[model samples]
Target: MAPEARIKILLKNGATALCAGLVALSSFSLGAEAARRHYRGHHHHIPQVPAAPPRALPYPQLPLPFEISGAQYLPLAWTDVKGWSDDNHLAAYKTFRASCKSINGQTGASEPKALGGSLSEPCRVAKTLELSDDAKAKTFFEDNFAPLRISRLGEPDGFVTGYYEPVLEGSRTQTDVFNVPVYRRPSNLFVRGYKQDSVSLPNKGPVYRKIGRRKLVPYYDRGEIEDGKIAGRGLEIAWLKDPTDLLFAQIQGSARIKFDDGGVVRLNYDAYNGYPYTAVGRVLIERGIVPKEEMSMQRIREWMAQNPDGAKELRRQNRSYIFFREVNLSDKDEAVGAQGIPLTAGRSIAVDKALHVYGTPFFIEGELPIDSERSKTPFHRLMIAQDTGSAIIGPARADLYFGAGQEAGRVSGRLRHPMHFVMLVPKGLDPSVRAAKLPVPDPRPSEKIAKLFPQTDPAKAGTPAAAAAPGKNETVATAGPVPLPVPRPAIEPAREPRRPVKNRSHRQQ
Candidate 1:
C-alpha cells in the first residue's frame, strides 16, 4: 500500500477508537445511576441515607457563585457592571486586539493553561470584525463573552496598585555625578536546580549562580552587590545619578535613560536574585517611622533624600536585586510588557499570571484618590492583562500601568485601593459546566457502619454521674459499652510563692 493510504487508515482507526471510548463512558455513567436508583428503592428504611443536594443549573443563575481551584466566580449580566455602559470600550478593544497578536500565534495545543484554548475562537472573531464605533466594540464583547465577578476564595474585593515607566537622567559610563551603576544579567546566573545552559527556564522558581563547573550557589544580594561585589565584569548597562534612582527603577521593572548628548537608552527587566522581595514602605510603617495612611512612593523618596544614611540601611533591608537588558524603543513608544506588546497607558494592567491569562479583559469599578491624597473620585474602566510582576500574586491582585514622566509616576505611586474585578471569560469555557463537573461528596455512612458505632444513651447523656470525675479509690462499673468521657475545663497553673529579699545596701554600708 502507498504511504499516504496507510496514514489515512491510521487516522481513521484513531477516530473510531476515540468514539468507542466515549460511548463506553456514557454507558458506564448510565449504569451507575440505574444501580443507585435500584439500591435506594430496596433500602428505603435506611435512616442514615442523606438527602440529595440541589441539582446544578446548566447555565449560571443569579445570586450563587461557583467556586473552582480556590477562586470564586459569580456570573453576571453586562448591565450589572457599574459603569460598563459609559466607559470607552473602543480603547479596551484596541488593546485586546494587540494582545491577540500574541494569543493567535499560539496553537490550540500550546494555548495558555488558564484559558484552556477558549480564547482561540474569540481571537478569530475579533480579527474578522473591523469595529469602528465604541457601541459596536461593546456589542462584540457582549456577544462573545460573559462577565464574571472574580475574587480569591476568602477575599471580599480585588486590590489594584499602579506602576509607571521611570525616566531618569543617566550616563553611559561611570562619571562623578552618575556613579551608581545599573548591571545587566550575569553570564553565570541560572535557574536553581537546572543546568547552567538551560534553554527554557520556568516562569516561577529561584535563581542561582554557577561557580566553576558543578557548584551552584545563590546569586549576590542587594547588600553584597552594593558593596562592589561582581564589579569590573563588563555588565554595566548605564549609570544613574544616585542609588534612589536605581532602586525605584528596579521596583518598577523598567526605565528610560536620558543622557546629556540627546541620547536615550531603554532598559527592561531581565532577571533577579533568588531572595524574596521585601517592600521598604511596609517596613517603615511597621517601625512607626511612617504612618500607614500617609505612606506613598513620593514620601519614601523625600525621606530618603533627607536621611541618606538611613535610606542606605532601608535599601539593604530588601535583599532582592534586579538586572536589566537594553531594549530598542523610540522615545515616543511605550514600554513593552511581559506579554511582549507595547502596554497601553491606563488600559493595560499587570495581573497574577498564574491565575489569569495575558489577554483577558477585566472591568474595574471603584473610587480612588486620583486628584489628591485624600480626595476620592469614581474610577470605572476596562483593562487588559498585558503584564505580570513578582508582587502581583493571588486571584484578585493587579497592577495598573500608567504612562511615563514625573506626573504619571506621582499618580501611580498614590494609587493603592480595593476595586471590583469582573473578568470577561469566553462563553466556550462555561463556569457552570466546571462547577457541575465537581464530584459530589460521599453521602453519610451506611446503616451497618452506624450500627457498629452506636450513639450514647440519651438517658445518661450529660448527666451528673456521667460528668463527675472518679476518685483514686473508686471502682467504676463497665457493664455495658463505655461512654466517652466528658472533657474537663482548663485550669490555670498555680503561681510560685513570693520570697523575701536580702538588704544588700545595708550590708555594703
Candidate 2:
C-alpha cells in the first residue's frame, strides 16, 4: 500500500513546483536587449571635425622644437582607377539582392542601371533605395548591409536619425577602443606601393645656404632636397603579425633583451621615442620577413643575428613611418605597454566624391584576406573621409592604414590586391561632386622632350628599348645620319668648266 501511494504523492508535488517556477520567469524583461540590439549602429558616424586635418598625416619623432619648416603635407590629387569605380566588387551585387526585397516597397527585381553600377552590401537597386517606410529600410539593411556597413563605419543612408553613440573603453593614457556594430566591408584596393620602400628626413643645415634660406633646420621634401643622405620622408610598409617588439628593435637597432631566466626584462632608453600610439612586438613568423618552414621566435633571433647584414631596419625609400599613440605600463619610463590609437595615420578608405560622397557607407570586394588567427575579416571597418596621404597623391588611390601594432602591420603589409568598391552615397546628393579639383593633363613625352632636348642629349630616357628582333631588347641605335626623303647620288664634282678650245683649233688649222 505504501509504495503505490508514494509514487502518486511525488507526482502531485512535482507539478505544483513547475507551475510556480513558470510564474516567476514570465515576469522578467521581455527580450529587452535582444530586441534593441539591431538598432545600435544608427548614430555612430561622425563627420570630419574642425580639428581633423585635411589629410591624415603620419606622426614621426623629431628633436626638441622640431623645426620642420620646409615640410609640406601633400594633398589628395587622385583621378583615375582602372576598374571597380562603378560595379567592381562582387559583394555589391549580392548586397542589392538581399536588401532590395524590403527596400523596393513592392518586390520584384530592379534593373541593373538602378543599382548605381556597383555591388556594395545593402546595395538596393540604387534606384530603389527610397526609404518610404521603416519596415523596408530595416529589412533591406538586415540581409545585405548588417554584415558590412550597418554596424561598422560610414553613415549608411539613415543610421543616425536613430539613437546611439560610440562607446570608448579606455582612459586618456590608455588605448581607447571605440566599438561600433555597423562598419564597412572593403571592396576596391587602391594600394600605392612606395617607389622605394623607405626614405629619411633631410638634415638641411649644411645645404640651406645654397638655397638662400639661412634660418633652416632639419627638413624633408615631398619633392627635392639637396642632401642625398637624409633618407626618406614618409611611412614605410611592412607586413608583420606582431610589430611591437619589432618596432622597438627597429628604433633601438638591437634585439629585445629577454632574461635567461625567462622572466620580465626591460630596455633602457626611449626605444619608443618619437613613435606615438604604436606598440612593438616580436613578429617574425607571419610576415615572411624571415622565411622558414618551421621557425620559432628564438630561431628568428638567430636568423637576424647570423645575418646581421639582413635588413636591419628593413626600411625602404618613399615610405614613411605611420605613427599612433600607445599606453605604456608605468613600470618603466615612457615604455608603451599597449598601443591605442586616437587618430589613425592614413586615409586608406575614402569616397569617390563623384560617386559615393564622404561619410557614405560602402563594401569593398577583393582577395586580400583577413587573418582569423589574430583578427578576422568582415573587418567591420570605418571611413573617416580623410583625404589622401603623400603616397596616395593619385586620384584613384587610397592609402590604407595597416593600423598600429603587429597584427595590423602584418595584414597591411600583406595587403597587395586589386579590388572594387560599392557604396551608398547620401540619397539625392549629386554624384557629380567636383571634389578633387582639376589638373592639366600630363604632356606627351615626345613633345615635352622635343621642347627640352632639341634633337640632342643622345635621345636617352627612362623608357625601355624596343624588341630588336623577337625576345631581344638592345636599345635601337639612333646614332646614324637622319634618313633622307629622297636618295642623293655620291658623285664627285666636275673639275673644269666648258672651254673655248674649239676657237684655238680653227686658227691653228
Candidate 3:
C-alpha cells in the first residue's frame, strides 16, 4: 500500500500509537547507522541532515509605534495629550499649511529620504481643506494623524530652548561708532570635500576656504574674523556698534539691522565657519562665573558689559561664526526660518532636521518661566517644526522661536526647560498595521540539537573533573594538574667531623 493509503488506514483503525512508534524507530535506526559506519571505519561520507524549517507562527510579532533615529515612540490617544483641547489649533494649522507648501513642492525624486512619501497624503488633504474654524482644524488633525509620545531613546523628557530675531542698531556702511562689520559669505568659502568654485554651497556640511588652487582650509572662525582677517575682502553687509551685538545676532542666526536714517536691513544666516557651537552661557556656568539659575541672554549681556575683555575672551571660546545674507522684507514681517518661510512666533520651532521632517507637528506641555524670571506658567501648545539649528540636536530637542525686539528676547532667553513631547504622525504610516504584519522570530535550536552534541552540567562547571576535561586546543596531560617539586635537606657532616677532631686533640693535651 502507498504511504498515503497506509496513513489513512492507520487513522481509520485508530493505530496512532503504532504510527508514532514507527517514526521514533526510523529516527533511531538512522542515528545508529551513522554511528556504526563511524566505528567500522568504512570512510563513507555521512550526509548532513538539513535542519527542519521553523514552524509558522499563529500571530505576527508586534512592532514599535514609529521609527525615528535616537528616539522611541509610544502610541497615545488625543485625549492623553494634556491641554490638547484648549490649544489654538487654528494657529498651528496655519503654520502646518505653510510648511506643506514646501512639502508639496517635493515630489517624485525630490521627496525627503528620511520621511519618504509618508507625509504626502496628509499634505494633499490639508491643501484641499479650507479650515477657518478651530474645531474643524482640530478634527482634521485627529482624523488624519495619530499622536505618539516621542523622546530620545534613553531620555525621559524633551528639552527646549528659545531664539529670536535680534534688532540691533547699525549702518549700511562702516562708521566711527558703528565699526564692527557684519559679514556676508566670503567668495573663497566652500563646503569641505567639494569643488572650491562650485556655484552654490550645500545646505549641510563643514565649510572651508580655498587658500590657493589646490588647498582647502577651515573658514575663518569668530575670533579670526573679529580680528579683521577677511576685512578688505568686501564681505561686510552691514556694521554694528560693538562685537557684543554681532555675537548675539550670530547666536540667534538672524537680525534686523536698523540704520540711523530709519532704513532697516534684514540679515539671515548664509553660511558658518564649520566649528562646533559652544554655548557661552554654558561656559559661564561651568567656570562658576554665572550661576545656572541666573544664566540668560540678558544676564550674559550684563556680565559682558561689565567686563569687556572677559566678554571678548568668552566670545573667542565659541569658534563657530555665522555669515549673513540680505533678505528683502518689510519692517512688519517676522524673521524667516531655515525653511525659507517667515516663522510664526511662539508656534514655529527648530527641530533636529537629521531626525525629524520639517513639516511635522509636535505638541509640547510643560511649565515655563515665561511671565517672569522665576514664574512657572503653563506652556501647553502645538508647535510646528519649521527650522533647524546647530545647537538643536537629538530627537526631542527643540528651539522655540520668539519674534523680534527686547521683550521677545527677554521671554525667549529665559526659556530653557524640560517638557513632554507628542508627535503627530500622519495616518498613511499606520504603525499598528505595520506592526501586525511583522513575522515572529524563529525558535532557538537548543532543544532540537541538544542530543547530538556533548553537554556540560552547570553545577559541575568549576569541579576538578570538569576542569580536567580537555578543551579543543588542550591535551589531556596539559589540562590535568601538575605535581609540585619537593625540596632536599642540606648536609652538615663536614662541620660535625671537624668539631669531633678538635675535642679529641684537647683531651690528648
Candidate 4:
C-alpha cells in the first residue's frame, strides 16, 4: 500500500486499458448504426425485446485527459415525495419520454417553432414534460404534469426534460461531461415547482447537489464500493469505448420567459444549468450546421459526416441519461487540519474564483460549529473537496449533498453553520478570496519533517506515491509542516510522465 507502488499499478492498468481500447477501435468499425430496445433492468421479469435498438445516444464521447479524483459539490434539494413506482407506468413514460425526445429533436427535427415559444420570445405554447425511464414515468407525469398552454393535440402537463450536449461541450472541448446544463426554459409547471418549494434553487451559483434517497445512501460504481458500505442508486452508467456525439434537444417549462433583449420574450430558465437544448439547437442551426427544418437527429449524423471527431461526442451524449434526487447534508461532521478525503455527502459551500476554485487543497484551522439536533459541537480539519452537486450554483452559495440514510437525512435537514476554513488553490491564483492565508513562518533553519519522523527519511519520501490503490483517493504524503500533499505534478509522475533514467555508475568500472 505504499504510495509509489500504488501509482505504478495505476499507471500499468491505465496504460493497459488505453492500449486495449485503442486496439478494439482499430479492429472494429464504429458508427451510427444501432438497434433500439426496451430495457427492463435485471430485476424485470419481462423477456428482453428491442423495438428500435439505439445505434447509440446522439452525443459524441470525448474522454477527459486525466482522472478527476474529487471536487467539492454544491447540491440541489429534492426527495421522492410520498409513493413513486416505475414498474406500472413505464409504457406511459415511454410515450412521454419518446414524445419529448422526438419533439426535442432526439430523433427528428427539433420544432423550435412548435408550441409557439422561442428562447428570444416566451413561446405561448404548453410546456413539455418528460416521463421517467421506468414504466411508471409516463403515468406519474400524466398525473402530476400541469401545463399552462394547451397542447396542440389537447392540453399539456408540465414535465419535459431537455437533452442537449451540455453547452460547455456542444460549444467547447473539455466538457462538463456529466452536466445537463440546458433545461433552459421552464414553463408554468416549473414556476409551480419553484414556487411551491417542490424544487429549490440553491442560493449559491451553479454547483451540483447529491441526488440521494431520503436516507443518504451514497451511489457508488461497483469498482468504488467498500465492503461494509451501502451503495447509492441512480441511472446506470457506462463509458463508451469510442468517443461520439449524439442527439440533443430542449424540453421547456411553462414559465413565460422574459428576455433581457426585450423585443420578444419567452421564459427559458435563466441559463442556470446552461442554455436549453432547443436554444442551443437554434444557435447551431442559425450557424448553419443543418437546415432549420432538418431533423436535428439526422443533422447530427450529417454534422458527424463533416466533423468526424465531433461525430463521436454527439452520439456519446445522447446515449447517457441520469435521474437524481438532491438531498440536504446539514447534520454531518467537518474535520479540519487532519489530512482526509471529503464525502460528497454533508453540507458544503462554493467559492468564486476570487476565493477558491473547485478542488482547492483545504485546511480548516479553527472550530466549525455543527448545527446539531441535540447540542453544539465543533469539528474541523483537513479534507479535500471531493465532489460538487447541482444545488451549489452560485460563487458564494452551495448545496450540501447529504451522504446516507435516515441518520444523514435527519442531520442534513438541519445543518447550517459558519466555520473558519482555508484553501490552497492551483498556485498563482489569488488566494484572498478563498480564506485568509494560513501562516507558515519561513522554513526556519533546519525545520523539516525529517526532524519529526527521523526514521522516515525525506529522501525515501521523495519516491512517487503509488497510484495503484484504486479505492483510496490520494495518499496524504506530508513533509511535516505541510499537512497536506501539495498537488505537485512533479511529485505525481504516474499521472504525468516518467522521470529521466539515471545514468549507470561509471566509477564502478
Give one digit per residue, the lDDT tens place, for model 4 in 1-509.
99999999999999999999998876554321221222333345666676886687444453322111222321111122112221234432332232232223323432221111111111111134343455444334323322111111221211111111111122111234432221211221122114413433322232222334223222332112212122123221211111222122112111111123432121111212221122334445666766664524334445666886555443333222112221222222221100112233232222222222233323232222235444555443322232332222222222233333334434433333333333322222222222234433377545675566434446655566532343567564434543557676665445766799988887856
Better of 1 and 4 by lDDT: 1
lDDT of 3 by residue, 1-509 (tens): 79999989878777777788899999999999988978667765667799998996666555454577788778788889999999999999998998899888875663343355677778899999988999999998999888888888988899999999999999888789989998888888877656644533444457788877878787888888888899988888988888989988988888998888999889887777788889999999999999999999999999999999999999999998888888877344998777777899999999877678888899999999999999999999999998877677788898899889899999999988999999888887767556666776666687655544546666886899878745678663322223337777786666444443433454555
TM-score of 3: 0.73
**Which prediction has the highest lDDT against the true structure?**
1
lDDT (Cα, tens digit) per residue for candidate 1, span 1-509: 99999999999999999999999999999999999889989976557878798897654444322333567668788888999998999999999998998989975375435566677788899999888899999998898888899888888799999899999999999989999999987789888666554532333457778888879788888999999987999999999988999999988888999999999998877677877778899999999999999999999999999999999999999998888888878444999887878989999999877677889899999998888888898999999999876667778888889988898899889987999999888887757656566556565577755566655566896799776767877875534455669899799999899898876765555
> lDDT of each structure?
0.84, 0.31, 0.83, 0.30
TM-score of 4: 0.20
Ranking by lDDT: 1, 3, 2, 4
Report the number of the highest-TM-score candidate: 3
Q: Estimate each model's TM-score.
A: 0.72, 0.26, 0.73, 0.20
Candidate 2 on 1-509: residue-level lDDT in tens? 79989999999999999998887676454455544554554645445567755673343332222111222111111122222233323233332333333344433553223123223323344455545554454344333332211111222221110000111122111122311111011111011231111222111112111123234332232112213222232211111222333333332211123222443222211111111221111234446655443433334445655654443443222122222212222322222211111222222242222222122334444333456323434432222322222122222223344334445434444433334433333222223232223233567788975565444233544335432333456444444334337767789988887766554455555
Q: Which is better, 2 or 4, measured by TM-score?
A: 2
Off by over 4 Å in 4: 1-356, 364-371, 393-402, 426-509
For model 2, what is the error of residue 66's alpha carbon versus the real structure, in angstroms, after optimal superposition?
Answer: 40
Identify the superior model by TM-score, candidate 3 or candidate 4.
3
Error of 3 at 260 (Å): 1.8
Ranking by TM-score: 3, 1, 2, 4
Better of 2 and 3 by lDDT: 3
Q: Which stretches of candidate 3 lie over 4 Å from their true place?
A: 1-66, 110-113, 192-205, 330-332, 443-509
Q: Kindly give the stretch of ten consecutive residues in candidate 1 with the minimal lDDT sum.
A: 59-68
CA deviation > 4 Å runs, candidate 1: 1-70, 193-204, 330-332, 434-509
